[model samples]
Target: MGSKLGYVYRVLKLGGSLITNKNVPFSFNEELVTNVVNVIKNFKVILVHGGGSFGHYEASLSKENTQTRTVIAMQELNLKILKIFNKENIPVFPLPGRYFTINQVLEILQNNLIPIIYGDILPNGNIISGDDITLTIAKHFHTEALFATDVEGIIINNTAVSLLKSLDDFREIRTSQFDVTGGIREKLRKIFQYKVNSLIFDGRNPTNIYYALSGKRIGTFVEAE
Candidate 1:
């Protein structure tokens, strides 16, 4: 489904917290992920995921020599996701962040398959956040992003902001202690930096995931102006 402009790909990110229990090390929310995958099987979306309890817990253990461990942990979680997709008969393939060039992803899409990439540790020990990967592909194709997170959306004053246009709107939002990749704040920063319109919705509610993918904004819409 490419055009003279580009492929009409829906760049979606499955937040680590949405699929894994962030508080428990290496805890994968299999049932929730299975429901999410069921909804995703209907669409050919470019999928990106966070480290969550997997790589994040390992990365928090040591600053040095954790690259291999982090990658392995993230892959372990990714493999679990792959298994779900496979069981549902969805065509998906994994592309490590290190090898996640635009062309490599497009090649998978060209074959009518979905490409799944995750937040990974770069060779230099830098953490490549999943939001970074999502923005990279979404910005390239000028596509809107769908972020299925644990929260309903960006909340302020106990209410979710329907439309967010500036960073000042949620400056007080706190980042997680276990999140090595700067958490939600970092995700918002990249969204604004790339100027990619995105919907940050709660994946806890299975209906929200379906609504988001169906183009119905069920969460906070970030429009970097």
Candidate 2:
């Protein structure tokens, strides 16, 4: 919601790896989403979630589904997420990223309802990444971004680097599974381009979100300073 001080918008992208069983086709981790949402429910957030097993697995030839089918599958998962937030008495306006523009989302947030979005197949049949969703919203609103993945943070030579000041600090990133968006490297590349600092943290720990949202020094930071 807007305040006289103006809304301090934040884009929180819930990684598919954290909220879904990547190994299991179409499987969603409802509990993990619930936990993460519970911790950040109070913030001025524009929530975007990954497709996890749902989008990736469905688009796989093994699943006998194409990108169109994947779109339907992801939307179904979106409904479930809305239900979970509803259970907690949280007001969320679920938006399908492809069809909805960021300004409409601003309208929802202005009305005091959180806007929930996700990675999905667009109407033109392109796979939308959760990172894409987060970046788009962040740029439109100039908000800080947070990517919540399953891992502790971005791992470099088997170590999770806590802060990144430039791309020269790292060389490569590992894609989890069925990821069509070019993985962690792409995410880092785009987020660093923002004028605001971005963060990557483990969503499995609810407290980490609490700490991060409260502006604590947690997770890996991609400093835009």
Candidate 3:
């Protein structure tokens, strides 16, 4: 409640696995994205999204020495998302994640415009992961971070680790996907840098998105103490 622009602010990320058919290239889940947007538009939040099939596949190809094409593909995917939010009247302003200065983001928030950014193609010919961007925003804003993923949150010993205190908490969980960026392990490490407690929840069900943002504990909260 510090600024009239943001009554309740949060740095939120929409995982690519939930917004797109990850196994298929260029598959955008418009329906699911729209549904999630409907619920999230009710709050004052900065939106960050991963490039699932869009960005990851490019990153993989670029790893083999084809970089420029990868950057273009990532930009294309970013535009697609920007259009989706704009069409819905979400009051979104788009920016490439790598070049997104904290001052720019804050100015947008100050003016009450929801900034929609994504892991973009940086000028240095590199790609930044959406999760990494979320971590940065969390630290800068000193606010809570939330990630919407495909699973039911970080699982351990056949149960969700409701309160993750350290990286050792996820020692045994295996990732079974073609992840170009570091998977869950990387996500855990990023949030830990600032000892920021973040909320990880399932985005497959739109209701879960609503519940977690409403602070009702529908998902696992990573404790960063």
Candidate 4:
């Protein structure tokens, strides 16, 4: 018999909604992260989280440069996430902009260590959103990537839309309607350009992460044409 197929590697780009709350004050959704980590326990995962309610709110209020304030807030949130992951015996390697480069991401992935990154404004005076980094890392490393967002994967008419399954389906729609940070659409565009397959899923349901990691159909798949 042939050798058994090895486990596939996956990188999950988690949205801010997974950690932070808009309605709650200075609090994180620790329970949600705990639940999600439980669901993802079986996989060899590299997690990238978005700077959620806390970072966005603080950045908006500080009147400081977006890069400065956002980076500081994200660092704090990253530690919070690390604490939760540590409680579950999941080793988290925090990757901030200062420590990240394309080569660094590859090295970490090759070592099978789960690296957690987040969206933040880079010191270069540009928004280094997580979506952008996810695409870059996916292309550079030749790995699969997934985006776990609050929504049910690019919705329209209260239903989930599959933009990649049929590119023509979204050809007429304005790109802005689909992305909040202006990076989701760009991520999809890169998916097409680089011939990489990615997915957008409802992170509120932690089991969806298990399905995605298992190579089962459970989310809106974005694939290269």
81-141 per-residue lDDT for model 1 (tens digits):
9999999999899988878899988888888888999988887888888888898888877
> All models: lDDT?
0.85, 0.78, 0.77, 0.68
Compose the digit string of candidate 2's lDDT tens values, residues 50-161.
8878887776555544767888878888888899999999999888867668777878887889989888776566777778778777777665688888888778778888
**Alpha-carbon runs more than 4 Å astray in model 4:** 1-7, 22-27, 109-112, 162-180, 183-190
| Native-referenced Cα lDDT, model 1 | 0.85
Pairing residues by index, what is the TM-score of model 4? 0.80
lDDT of model 3 at residue 29? Answer: 86
Candidate 4 residue lDDT tens string, 106-194: 56656666788777765674556676677766665467678887667865556676655545454323332212354455556666776
Residue-pair clash count for candidate 4: 0
Q: Write the per-residue lDDT of candidate 3 for residues 1-225, one digit (tens) a residue.
A: 233454667788998878776777778888888888889888778888887887777676636543565667667777777777788887787777767777888878877788887876665656688887887787776777889988887898888867777877576466535567777788888888767778898999999888877766656788874
Q: Which candidate leads in TM-score?
A: 1
How many collisions per candidate? 0, 0, 0, 0
Better of 1 and 2 by lDDT: 1
- What pairs collide in candidate 3? none
Best by lDDT: 1
Candidate scoring better on lDDT of 1 and 3: 1
TM-score, every prediction: 0.94, 0.89, 0.89, 0.80
- In model 1, which runs have C-alpha deviations exceeding 4 angstroms? 1-7, 171-174
